[model samples]
Target: MRKLDKNLTETLRKTKYFLLDLDGTLYLENKPIGDMKNTLKFLRDKGKKLIYLTNNSSKGAHTYVEKLKNIGFYEEGDLVYSSGVATIEYLNRYYKGKSVCLLGTESYRQEMINGGINVVDGDRADVAVLSYDTELSYEKLCNFVRAIHFGATYIATHPDVNCPAEDVYLPDAGSFIKMIETALGYTPKVVIGKPNNIMGENLKAKFSENDDFSFMMVGDRLYTDIAFGKNCNFPTMLVLSGETTEDMIPSAEKQPDFILESFNDVKNYF
Candidate 1:
């Protein structure tokens, strides 16, 4: 095996779970980046768990699973964990039994229901969850805003303003949050996704028995991915294959513990 710098090698060795961002981190749109399949397989071959973590809640985990598997990035034991799933974890633990008004895609709504959450229309909601609601409509927005005005606790799934695409960027959950703020002059009380600890807490719980398990967050976005690792108290690795470039590193507020040209490049340091 090729040996890396002491710290990088140690971080790689110690990390039992790698929380990976999907869009810009691993692949672009529908294709894997630079032998990504081989790199991930090498990690798993060494017994490292790969968790395809994403902030987009517009789709369910199965959707991502299908995408990853089709692209050959997925293996039998690998997992896809999304902000929507993490939000469900948060709701069950903190607001269990509460009527939740969700401004999200129908698939995500089903995910919440499957997690034992009581999904209600915004009019009757005791809590409102804002996710990447690709199915968002005027009626849904009005109801979600009204629920918050009526004292429903507001929570956002993530803070990403835009999502990367093969061509153009699309508005994400954070854009919706900003819209709500513009309309209601209020924001969510808690954001459940990246740069937050809820997802990290869920991971901790999932791997609780293994106290030796350390986490590492790898991605392309500095604010979301690197910041999340910092929030989760995990080592962070920034990859250049996505949104961020080498020039953007110096001015970034969230500096990663390691940097690489692309995620597949980790094999060099191993």
Candidate 2:
């Protein structure tokens, strides 16, 4: 572990929970980024709670669990939370029992159905939800555009432009959103993920109300991850393993409290 200043060490002492970003901060695609399992175990041993928070809404908790397990970072008890879960919570709260046209993966659609959303195929949907659809097809794109033109209320799970992979970045939900906006001249009515209050509300509902644990958000993206932490009043840590770089920090609208080369550097702190 690297040496920590007194102030940072004090803050660490008070922090009882870590809200972790998955895709960029911990791993890229199917590959692990660091000795994450041991680092998590180290934090666990210190009586800290860990929750994997992700903005990728294409996959649900089950898929994430399997992926994490494959990368050797997940255990039976660890919680995996995603924008899809938050989006479902938002839908149930505001648009309960409404017909939804989802532009997402098959897994995401199934998860939404399981969460009580009425996923439909036609243009006569009450809501048009967009996600990071890795399995996105041209036919699906046409259908979604048709729904938008037909006046279905638009919603997005998150505003991430790209999702990091091992070697390249895949265009994410935000990129799709920009395309739609350019074609139709409209934006989403609601975005339910990071840097949005819906996810924060969902987190509050998931965690115990009585437990006043000091929290920190650790991630790589300045917009989604760091902005989310700032918006929700949690301390933020920026990792350079993914989307962000040191040169970009000067002009960033949102900034981190601490910066590290990668999550591997974080392992040293413990």
Candidate 3:
């Protein structure tokens, strides 16, 4: 564990719930970050509730649960929330019964359908949703653009431009949005994931009734992860095991309350 200054140490003592980022902060690719298992245990032993929060909309809750369990970061009864869930909730609340055309993976589309969203074909849509489509095709992009041009309302699951995948970065929803914006000259009216308060609302709906309990957001990226915590009014902890580095912090618009090398370093807090 890395040593912490007095202020950060005090801040950690006040925190009760941790909304954790999975891919970078917990594990890089399929490999666990150093000493992560014991670090998680230490937090649990100290009565800190762990909730896995991810902006990756490509996979659903079940898939994430399987992945987390396989990587040994997930315990029984741990809650996992994804951008897809928040997007579904957003659709249900504001656009219930509207025909939605999803530009995402088949699994993400199915998850939308399972959540009682009215996902339909492009031609039949009244709204168009964009997400992290790992299986995106040129045809799908064209269809999505046409749908929006035809007056369909636009919404995005998250605004992340890139997704960290081990040694590489994959273009995420925001990148696709940029292309579409360039082509169609429009952007999504609502983006429901990180840096937006919808996720925080979802979190508060599940937990956070007690004033005595404080919350923290722990993740790797400054824009999505740390920004999310700031938007939610939760203290942010930046970990460098993934998208960000120490050099990236100075010019960042949103700075984290604490910074650590990896999840292994979090052990010093508790």
Per-residue alpha-carbon lDDT of candidate 1 for residues 25-85, written as tens digits (9 for 90 to 100): 8888777887999999999998999999988899988899999999999899999999999
- For model 3, residues 52-73, the per-residue Cα lDDT tens digits are 9988899888899898888788
Q: Judging by TM-score, tell me the better candidate of 1 and 3.
A: 1
lDDT over C-alpha atoms for residue 70 of model 2: 82
Residue pairs with clashing backbones, model 3: none
Which of the numbered candidates is closest to the native, going by highest TM-score?
A: 1
lDDT of the candidates, in the order given: 0.87, 0.83, 0.86
Where is model 3 more than 4 Å wrong at Cα? 1-3, 208-213
- Model 1's lDDT to the true fold? 0.87
User: CA lDDT of 48 in candidate 3?
Assistant: 84
Preferred candidate (lDDT higher): 1 or 2: 1
Model 2: weakest 10-residue lDDT segment is 204-213
By lDDT, the best candidate is 1
